[model samples]
Target: MEHKDNRYTISGTDIEEVKRKNGQSGMSYNEAIEWMAKTTGGRGTAIYSDTNMEEVKKQNQSVQDYNKNKA
Candidate 1:
């Protein structure tokens, strides 16, 4: 789901949305994703590689754990 932006030469899913949320309306690609992960609910499970996916799942679990404790 790569959304290509001709103006900035960047690509990602929901590039405009990510940029809008981050107040970086020009940012794109991995920067957008990492920022979104930090700001949003949890780092989503699905990623590029199997090993990385597992790591993301673990990180997501930790995030959920922290939030659960806070609540």
Candidate 2:
């Protein structure tokens, strides 16, 4: 699993993977969170209980945006 500021990708199923999967899928942050939860069977830290998802999402967004341009 690859860890990001805002989330973790399990088995190559992170935001970028999803974004690429559906072609401009426009998946919401919450949807992504839920998707991760379902996919990992609660193994993903990004969607684990006691997590402040909104905060993680905000923090991660900045990093993701930066990476987008940097990459």
Candidate 3:
């Protein structure tokens, strides 16, 4: 039942699905978004045209670079 910018696309069911899939995996929301982006072969915010695609790219890249450094 998360609402963002007056958009009500995601429902409680969706959250449950996400939680179920993330069980014992410790996947944060950002990690899920990144994984979805990689799996779908598209930028994560492709559905939100108002979002800056470049920003998403930078975020995804930053996460990857951080993981690389951490490892």
Candidate 4:
């Protein structure tokens, strides 16, 4: 599924919760992407593909392989 660029807010309570969990708050788009990739075991670029579906799938598989081998 394609990921949408949804907006998220870092409220004071949210920030405090993040701090309690030793997490960082107030991330930009790029930062969120990196965080997602790190947290979910996938690449950030997979969410922003501009190529055709088949090519995107191929690239995504290649990236997954690369990431898996790098681990």
Candidate topping TM-score: 3
lDDT of 1 at 56: 85
Best by lDDT: 2
Tell me the TM-score of model 3: 0.33
> Over the stretch 1-71, how does candidate 3's per-residue lDDT look in tens digits?
45673323454246655556779678778776766665665554455234577999999999999999999
Per-model CA lDDT versus the true structure? 0.62, 0.69, 0.66, 0.63
- Please provide, for model 2 over 1-71, each residue's C-alpha lDDT reduced to its tens digit, 9 standing for 90 to 100: 44564443554446756657777766677776777776765665454456677998999999999999999
Whole-structure CA lDDT of model 2: 0.69
**On a 0 to 100 scale, what is the lDDT of residue 41 in model 2?**
52
Candidate 1 Cα lDDT to native: 0.62
RMSD of candidates 1 onward, in order: 14.9, 22.6, 16.4, 16.5
How close to the true structure is residue 61 of candidate 2, measured as C-alpha lDDT?
A: 100
TM for every model, in the order presented, reads 0.30, 0.30, 0.33, 0.29
Q: Which runs of model 4 end up more than 4 angstroms from their true locations?
A: 1-51
Indicate the worst ten consecutive residues by lDDT in candidate 3.
Answer: 5-14
Whole-model lDDT, model 4: 0.63
lDDT of 4 by residue, 29-51 (tens): 77777677656656546664343
Q: Would you list the clashing residue pairs of candidate 2? A: none
Residue-wise C-alpha lDDT for candidate 1, range 12-71, written one tens digit per residue: 356556567778456657766766665663447235223465788999999999999999
